[model samples]
Target chain A: MKLNERSVAHYALSNSPADHMGFLRTWGGPGTPPTPSGTGRRCWFVLKGNLLFSFESREGRAPLGLVVLEGCTVELAEAPVPEEFAFAICFDAPGVRPHLLAADGPAAQEAWVKALSRASFGYMRLVVRELESQLHDARQSLALHRHSSWKAIPSRCKPQAPDHLSRGLENGYALSRDCSSIGLAEEGGSRPAGSGLAECELQGPTNLLLGRGQSPVSPETSCFSTLHDWYGQEILKLRQGWLQRARGSQPECEEQDRP
Target chain B: MRYNEKELQALSRQPAELAAELGMRGPKKGSVVKRRLVKLVVNFLFYFRTDEAEPVGALLLEHCRITQEEPSGFSISFIEDPERKYHFECCSEEQCQEWMGALRRASYEFMRRSLIFYRNEIQKMTGKVGMGHGSGRGWLVAWLTLCCPPHRTPWSSSAYRKRPGSS
Candidate 1:
């Protein structure tokens, strides 16, 4: 298949942080002259996510070889030379030889093997999904805890804004606790506007505030609305309990003094 | 830069996350929309001739932007050249949204950012929640070590080889 070579090469040379990097002795790989003897050539190898690129030297501007570390196995293998701390990246494809590489020490060899083994797009996605579910569970429990704690306090001592209880569930920004403040109104007013959607995109991690952004393809209901409704249910249940208590104590205060 | 095309070809044959015969057009000027079997395998979007088993071209979803086009269509352009977009026409608006969402989440960088965000959130939460709530922490940290041996995680080597999500 015709791959986007220009973009691929540009990605290789991009300023993104390298996952791992070191000089490794290579043998029987693409762009390297094969040797009958076991004396492999030494080159600088950099691991960036799933792509493994090799450079001529530490300062080499261009990459010599690119290996997409997918559908492959990284195994500790016997090197051509003795005590070389070698590992091989073996692919399942027929007629394609495993790329043999040797690290400087046992530590480096183990590190390279670990990085290369986990360097696949699927593995990364798996971890992200796992964490996503965990965060969801955490938020659920936190909301439950907040509800119970809010119940313990007397209705007379209740906070001015019952809405703060729901808004506090949000992670990235601090919602205004003062119900009558202009800040809270501005913040609440902006949420449903179409322009607010861009600020809420979870596409890039550079904007940490957008981490809790709703998935664009999800149903029209924002997570904020879902969360609001969820907490609103808790508030409703609490309100009913408080109303019964207020009615039993003093019916006169029901409308004017009830929290 | 030299890479093994055979390895990538083998990957293209693996089960896809999504597969459909969509109206596709290349970034080239005057390119016409052609019926192509597009397969999303991991982070690569491979497009094949309707009748062929092998793919004609593969676009790496990394560093690429997926934008929704008008009327049941979407275009994918790279960060390198924003104007050069590979347009795709879906049969329905729902399908277009599905394609765009999948394509948006298809990049390694996007996955990485998500992982980091979740990792940080989980870490911050574990401190507050404590004990049993942090069970996922072990798996996150041990992901590298867990995949060290031949024992594969669900999305690891064996899973890729198995090609689970063919549709």
Candidate 2:
């Protein structure tokens, strides 16, 4: 989130109802669409209710995710807007938040009831935790970017040279390898922390935001629509392979699950 | 490494659940059964089964080795105790590839140690038989070092995972 964008995000978030909402000024997620070299644009997210919206241009916009909170995911291929690239939006990351609330439509009572129910409540709480952590990470990244005063350095992450990767460690895509079983202590045991947080991406605890991934942002959505879409699905996909493995487990492991 | 209910529910879902189902190797009672589940939390890939959700079997990546088998499967075993292995089989080469990729990425730090250890082992051989360019043993050791222990254990998850709505 840039300096100005943070203010808008703060207002939007602060003004809205406290439950089921989150906003972040994003630099885009993995596989963002291509953009021109230096656009200096960013995105504003309005995660209200079940919809996660990435409103572009920040001007007036017609009905989008706000139209409906139905759970069916669709890929909008820049239908009316020629200037936009196709993007997908989903109300549920599926296995990330499972609920008995059927796909009939908005189960207002059921959703609220499920929100208080055991599994669904857990799922919603988890989503809150995820968004909170993401918000924290975004703030931390912003802090790092402003580590030095702007008068001294416009941005902590100065755009590196095009051939930075070839320069090796100076400012490039450096990789660290490991083989030890996350080397846990010999005492007691470690649990899977939890599930559905499938992205389980190996983001380094030490200055990972400085890692070679964030591209210069622009107000243009074309570069980030795909990426945000990818982040939406991939972030929830890796850890919860049930959607993938469920196809095989029915008969293969039915006996084992019976007990 | 801290995850909430949703992630916990997800972990209790498939693949990991399938692993738990498969990891149930001992004799079982119909009414009361113990299921060991796979949890990739914080820095550790833990295996636990209990009424209280604790891992009964844990394998530290620091002392482990992954051996990919013929067709479509791989086994993660303790290097210190090879007999203790967590073997997995995939329906296809693709699934096998994903599992391997996730395992390696999760245990990357440990694998780095193995890389150093194996590279040093390869270096010892190259030193003994000088890099004659055409030296078969030297070349073989180098090739094995690249493909065998760490570098080319090519398991892919982020790449293999199917994208949503791209059909």
Candidate 3:
């Protein structure tokens, strides 16, 4: 197949952050098979995303060998040489020999194995998607809290929350636009009916509250339990505000509301 | 750079993320659009003859731009040479948008950026919440620093230095 070798090489030489980098004794490259004697050339290996590039040395600009870490499994293996920390990146492809590599110590060996194993495009996507959903949940809950509080006091200092929240959403929209613009909207639309109650509660006043920071898009984590606890604290504050208001004393609600 | 083509060929044989017989055109001079089975697998976009099991070519989606062309088409061009583009024509505008979105997200760099962005936002939210409550941020930060120290390559004061540009 006609591979984009030039661009791949450029990416290897680029200054993008290397996921893992260390010296490794490599046995197989291209037509070479793993030698039974375990003797191999030690090269500086840099793992960039899913591509693993081996240089002639640490300062070598050009890579001698490139291994795309897809459709492969990393396993601990016995090195041909005794006392050497070794691992093998094995691929199930026919005629493709396993790349036997040895690290300096046990820690390095374990680290390499872990890094290589997780260095697939699919793994990264799964994590991103998880975080995306988590961020969505966070926003939904925050909107719900704001709605309840706004209803309690109809004419107070309008907390600058919808603006801030929409700023974050704007950033998110921009970031998602590069990949899939419709993805965020689709996610928002497909949310369960329970959150739709929150949506219904948020619409009236928040719809009129113009977001100031609606600049072009950007990008969150999965902290559901912690978020729930945080929102629980918010509920407490809301209850306190209601109690104070019932006593004919309007406390500075905005101070407690600022996030 | 020497890499095993057989390995990539094996990868192309794996189940695809999206596969369709689309009209493809190379960046070569006077290249005309032709029907090809384009399959996206991991970060590689492999194009093959409809009848062939093996791919005719593969494009690594890293450091590349997927720009939507007018009238149900899109083009992919690498950072190295933006002018040279591999164009694909979809059946409809919706199909073209779908292909463009898939191609844009098919890069490892995109996934990496998304990861970093999510991590940052998560940290901000967690820190805000953990102001009164203690957090595991220390461990997370330590782990992140160990795994992904920004701008720092592996070697530092090692006694090994090679001439640059040597292969």
Estimate the TM-score of every prediction.
0.66, 0.24, 0.65
Compared with the true structure, model 3 gives a TM-score of 0.65
Interface RMSD of 3: 13.4
Local accuracy of candidate 3 as per-residue lDDT tens digits, B73-121: 9999989899999999999987886677667667777666655555566
Measured with C-alpha atoms, the lDDT of residue A93 in candidate 3 is 68
Point out the worst 10-residue segment of candidate 1 chain B by lDDT.
B158-167
- Between the candidate structures 1 and 2, which one is better when assessed by DockQ? 1
Candidate 1 residues lying further than 4 Å off, grouped into runs, are A29-37, A149-259, B128-167
Shift in Å, residue A78, candidate 2: 62
Model 1, C-alpha of B16: deviation from truth (Å): 1.1
User: Interface RMSD for every prediction, one decimal?
Assistant: 13.6, 21.3, 13.4
Off by over 4 Å in 3: A30-38, A147-259, B128-167
| Per-residue lDDT over A1-259 for candidate 1, one digit per residue giving the tens place of the 0 to 100 score | 6988778777878876577889999885544554323778789998877789998899888888888887676666767787687777777678767888999887788668766766765445434533443454455445545566434332212121112212221110111111111112223232222111112122222222232345411223324447555434434553344344334535332221211
Worst 10 residues of 3 chain A by lDDT: A199-208
Q: After superposition, how far is residue B12 of candidate 1 from its true place, in Å?
A: 0.8
**Clash count of each predicted structure:** 0, 29, 2
What is the C-alpha lDDT profile of model 2 across B57-135, one tens digit per residue? 3332333466786667677765434654556556677666655655554432332232333334334423331333421
The digit string of per-residue lDDT tens for model 2 on A1-259 reads 0011222233233333322212212223334343322222344334332223444544424212221122222222221222223232222334432211111122332222221211111122222223223332233334444453423321212122111111211100011011010111101112121222311234321112212223212112322334345344543553344334444334533322121
Candidate 1 docking band: acceptable
- Candidate 2 docks at the CAPRI level of incorrect
